[model samples]
Target: MRRPRSPSFQVTPKGERLDSHFISSLSRPFYLLLAITTASLVAGVWRWQASPSMHGAIAFVMIWATLDLLFLLAALGVLYEKPQRRSEPRAWLDEELVLWVEGRPFRARASDGSRLGIGVDIGFSELDAATRQRALDLFHKAAIVTLRFADGKVLQARIENRQWGPRQQHLHLGLAYRFANIQDERYAVDLAFGDSARLQENLDRRHQGKSILGALAHIAVLAVIEGSKNLWWQLRNLWDLAYGAMGRTLRHGKTKELT
Candidate 1:
């Protein structure tokens, strides 16, 4: 007899569903439009074959369907501009952690983490310019960092990169692990990819995207506004050139008459 598979190895339909609900919502309209257009075009061709007198009716249907296909293409172009989140699993932390840089401590929160590295947002609220600069410089120099977890586990890491956001409100650091012990490595792995469901939920929340109609409307409005602006500028430039040429022509005519 064959043995039953473990829960972890079992296949679940829900788990294998489409990546995002918004993608389904956006795609349904395209599929529906394509189906309708194909049916209409096919029917028109069939009717025209049966009765040649129906040529005008078939031509009208063809034109209408072609316009709809153009609209569908425009919708797709707009969808391409929408923001897409990374598919890689990541764990985000709500509480802050303590990071020791060259014996000086700074508070930072774990923004994102993977098996490769951890990204932190270090706050510089109470520190002065020189102190903040010192901290940032230390982090940039690839110095060793000690992170203290809420559970009292200490992990050592080295800075991989650093970035400062808007007005230097906080500093972002990308830290690579320099594990001194086995427990720390295991803890980091567990923190990175241990909870797949939790990470998926976080990803889904970021993908709260617009529906098909909303996306189409947004694209249409922006296109019209931008097109009008370009048209106005082009016409204004043409008018300026025409006016300047006319003045030059009149001046030349008078100069020739005087000569």
Candidate 2:
């Protein structure tokens, strides 16, 4: 296996590092989309006003502009979301680790690691009901576990966090190592993070994104839901006022007849 590179970021000309620029980079495409949408919308409106016969063109442009605008706004929402406090850079890994929990052995894949902690993925369905319960119990007690790698390396760490989340069916286990000395700490760091090239690779992979159709659909749905809410309230208020006026008119007619 190639040695991991050190965790040093290649800074941009704007003096922004990877950690700080990640969010803004995600919004770049959204900004482009919104600009194109706005230009198209203005042209479409101008054409409609000049010809009045291009109703179809204007209608299509309007719908496209709405979806694009909403999607861009949704992207901005994520871009400006509060940042979470994090620890040291974790090197991504996918190697088998033999986890010893209370003398019992369980198989897991080491997913990522830092100097102080490592994350693993375990097959949730592979464990028996009793063992699954025991794993949960260990998490609550901050259980110390001994894990062995395929290369005969071993480490004793405390199970600091456990999350039973969806990943084609796997549970995430986070471990914080209990090092006895500096040597142990150095060994743990080298074993987990290597040189840190994997961490940078992971960051690069995040930038090579997939399709945005799902995001557009999601934002469109939210916009429709919010607009419908306001429409419903306005309609309800109008109905109440109209009903009250009719009732008052009927009472006035009855009083006139009696007089």
Candidate 3:
């Protein structure tokens, strides 16, 4: 008689899933933006001292404050832009053992009876050619799914990596939920690949919309900053001219009085 295999040896969602490291990658830029704001404020104040005029002081304060505010707001945008937690190759499995033991995690379903995260670990090795194509089609349906944690906080998760290369054989992904119950069960998805080829042109084409929007946003921000550079320089130059003329006049007046 054939022996029953241990469930852990098989590719199953029940195994300990790896942790996602995307958040760590994002922290550096987030903190750098904050540091830039602080530095700009200090430098702006130092430069403001050179003016010594009432209007210059006001302008310095205003511009300095504005830049600092812009930096801060931009930093906040970066800081708030938390990467959605999910399982990837190095993904995290929420292990609040107590929560699972206590049954405290909340899970709901869509209008259809499909459980929020209830998934079956179907392997590529098991499927025939026709079924394999169908599986790949469903992988193409992968999307960035958003979920709310037990605390009601929301998070985003990418079902498929947009940058996945054509040469890749199988699909790897992470599922993340914000404020997940530490005790909730961890899941895994395994796709066995018999043949690896670039799936289709349409899969790659589907992401162009997001890419275009991101590009447009970057261009808009760049245009604003580039347009303002000359204006800032002109105001700065006018301040210096006024201050220099005043100092020269005072020196001349003092010399005449002494003579």
Query: What digit string (tens of lDDT, one per residue) describes model 2 on residues 1-259?
Result: 2446755566554422233312344655655776787788888778888878889878887987876767565655556423222355667777898988777778889888878888888775766778677766664565788888897877888876677776324678788888778877887778765656765777798776546886557667765554344334445757999999999999999999999
User: For model 3, how does the per-residue alpha-carbon lDDT over 29-93 read when each residue is reduced to its tens digit?
Assistant: 53466457557766766666755566566575667666555544443344332343233223112
For candidate 1, give the lDDT.
0.70
Query: C-alpha displacement of 141 in model 1, angstroms?
Result: 2.8
- Would you list the C-alpha lDDT of every candidate in the order shown? 0.70, 0.70, 0.42
Cα lDDT tens digits, model 1, 50-160, are 989878978887888766755654554444322223333457745468999888888778888866568888888788898888876776675778988777888888876
lDDT of 2 at 23: 39
10 residues in a row with least lDDT, candidate 1: 15-24
Instruction: Rank all candidate structures by their TM-score, best first, as comma-separated numbers.
Output: 2, 1, 3
Error of 1 at 40 (Å): 27
Model 1: residues with Cα > 4 Å off, grouped in runs = 1-89, 206-209, 213-259
CA shift at 178, candidate 1, in angstroms? 1.5
Give Cα distance to truth, residue 148, candidate 1, Å: 0.8
Candidate 1: TM-score?
0.47
Backbone clash pairs for candidate 1 read: none
